[model samples]
Target: MTFRIGSGYDVHALVHDVSRKLILGGVTVPFDKVLRGHSDADVLVHSVCDAILGAAGLGDIGRHFPDSDPLYKDISSLILLKRCANILNEAGYAIENIDTTVFAQAPKLEPYKDEMSHKIASTIEISPESVNVKATTTEGLGFEGRGEGIAAHAVVLIRKISKKSG
Candidate 1:
């Protein structure tokens, strides 16, 4: 079986806007600040989508879902993820496993990691056990450490599906 691995990273600044909700991994976590982006700005989902697309030989998320497009304005990152899965399927690829990590300094994410993994797996039509979600702090060394922004990294393993002989 042909296998490919890809990694992706993404970050978004946090803004003090009560009108915006803090969504991470498709789950809304109550926080004073929300990520500023054209979409819901779910860093975890964005990173995962990029990783999958990269592994499948497709372009990055920005190429497929441009921020300049009004159609993606305030769109849910989960929706983008679903489209990525479809793109991979069309390219004759199947996801094997995915690992991801979220970097932040506030609003602890341990409580939501499992849910995040499950949500991502469901969105990609993969087994929950195939996805792993983790979170960490920067120990006060960067934008994420300073709570000014949130970032996430994702790595995915995908394989080409072989056709069955008649």
Candidate 2:
């Protein structure tokens, strides 16, 4: 059996719009500013997707879901995460576990960590115990701390599925 580990990081600027929900790992985190991106811009999910692809020896998110593609216009990032899992499964890789952290100074996320974990696990067709979502602040030091943007980091472990168990 072969195992691989990969990590990904993502950041998006917060826009002035209040209409868009601040989604992280498919869970809505209420905030006045929404992330700016071609997609729904769930930074946590995006980071996880990248991590999965990385572990699978696939290219990054931009290679799979380009911003220039209209097919992904304003699409939910959870959907993208699902696709990533499918890709890995088709490549004979199984998800071992995923850990992630969201960097934000506002709209405290301690309460939503469990829900985020559940959402991410469901999206990838994995057990909730295999997913861990955490949140932190930069102590008002950077763009995330200053409330200008949000960021997330994710690490994933994937193992090649043995033919007997696959």
Candidate 3:
């Protein structure tokens, strides 16, 4: 019956000479080097998943999906996000909305914002308006500024499912 908000942030190191693919809101983006990780290394989805889990008091993405497990090797973050949604549902939490931001220095993302929003919303069964994805750069400052890697931040609001019917 109450509303709660949670924020999640994640960063991954960019390995040199590796392919880069930024996956935001379940949509894959084109870039020179992809994020390096045990899974697909989608920084955007990872942050979103963590936010939902944090809001629902379900730990974090790493706890639910361990990198040590070979089963998750190169796994699609979309799949991980689906699992996170199930966890929230099982805990009687209804998603209200989610806003996400991606930090990158190359391959402007403005062109793909719509597709990213639609994909993430559909994957979580939420209205497209409920999910928002934005992209920005550090203006050439730190690791992200140097294009060493990509990072994402997400804030999610959830409401407890009421026992009484409407």
- Residues 1-166 of candidate 3 have per-residue lDDT tens digits of 6998878899987764355455656677766666788888888889989999999788999999999999999888899988998888888898999999999886688998889888888888999999999999899988999988889999999999954233
How many Å off is the CA of 119 in candidate 3?
Answer: 1.0
Between 1 and 2, whose lDDT is larger? 1
Q: For model 2, what is the error of residue 113's alpha carbon versus the real structure, in angstroms, after optimal superposition?
A: 0.8
Supply the TM-score for candidate 1: 0.96
Query: Per-prediction TM-score, please?
Result: 0.96, 0.95, 0.92
In the range 53-111, model 1's lDDT, one tens digit per residue, is: 99977999999999999999999999999999998888888999999999999989999
- By TM-score rank, best first, the candidates go 1, 2, 3
lDDT of 2: 0.91
> How well is each residue in 5-86 modelled by candidate 2, as lDDT tens digits?
9899999998887668788889888778889999999999999999999997899999999999999998999999999998
Number of backbone collisions per candidate, in order? 0, 0, 5
Residue pairs in steric clash, candidate 1? none
